[model samples]
Target: MNNDILDKITFDTGGLVPAIAQQHDTGEVLMMAWMNRDAVLETLEKGQVCYWSRSRGKLWRKGESSGHVQRLVNFRIDCDGDTLLLLVDQTGVACHTGRHNCFFQSVRDGEVEIISEVEISPDEMYGNKSGGK
Candidate 1:
């Protein structure tokens, strides 16, 4: 619970650090996000995932509207000391597209094929929080 470890982390020029979220039990990578100092503190203290949205330019709580909250199981730091690995217990689909993970498509040979389909629609997952067009 010491701040020394967190203090050593190096942030990018934008004052944001990359945070990788992984499924704790399965060891599957869920997503990667940016976190500012406050986001980090908020996550640790709350045991909920938080990120600094680059596009939105604000602090976003994981599953704030989608109800796909990622509960923090364990938090880790890489050897290089620039990134964080958050082991999470995901509530629902991690991707906005309603897939289990963000990486649904893989490069097979030279063609990119759709290996999975959206489990739910954007409206169902994100609701009005996304402000659809």
Candidate 2:
């Protein structure tokens, strides 16, 4: 199918939309990322998960810096055409904190708390600052 087929889909305010990655077999939601047109196009064309980095303001390939690539298996649009559900085969940790997923924490009692401990050191993925502050 051509990318044009998705021209009917509606994108939101930032010319970007929410994309959720779920495990193809187990149906576990792996992560959520923003996707602009180019990211969506590149994801489909490359079969690798590509996301728009909000903080750095650039296109970020999932495993480029962390070696935790998300392989695309399939994709679908929400009924309103504003959200995307991606079926993927994820490799390594999906969270920057090196957990299986970014949603390692759960909220309860109107407060947020950590449900999972760090699976790997942040320095392993993001490097560290030597200054003690």
Candidate 3:
């Protein structure tokens, strides 16, 4: 699979690099997550996005629970080699809050405003009330 490029990535001390998921066709950013070496390799091998869940301390297969899977289109590393960009075809809402993306908050005039509305209820996505990401 020519994964030699992985060697050039500089993961942090936690063995994780910030991965930003962006829509492949459009420029809309879906979400940001963390990826360890295994997560990165798994995503490449499986053609689906996988992330390291810092809160759960485990490999988080996106859409495993929400059915909002992200299919890998392209993977890229920043010039600094410390960050990664994943161009993906998103299946559904990316945010746990049921928003299309995570960056729903906007700050203007020193006031925080929500720029996006929830498309789906988190309860419906997670099948629970916690609405966790």
Per lDDT, the best of the predicted structures is 3
Model 3 has a clash total of: 0
Candidates in order have lDDT scores of 0.84, 0.81, 0.93
Tell me the tens digit of each residue's lDDT in model 1 across 64-92. Answer: 87878999999888888799999999998
Question: Would you estimate the TM-scores of all the predictions?
Answer: 0.91, 0.87, 0.95
Candidate 1 to native Cα RMSD, angstroms: 2.2
| TM-score, predicted candidate 1 vs. hidden true structure | 0.91
Model 2: pairs clashing at backbone N, Cα or C within 3 Å: none
Clashes of each: 0, 0, 0
- Model 3 TM-score (2 dp): 0.95
At residue 2, give the lDDT of candidate 2: 88
- Candidate 2 lDDT over residue span 1-133, tens digit each: 5866468567787888899999899988878889888888889889999988887788888888777789999978888888899999998777777777778778899989887777767677655622110
Better of 2 and 3 by TM-score: 3
lDDT of 1: 0.84
Higher-scoring candidate on lDDT, 1 or 2: 1
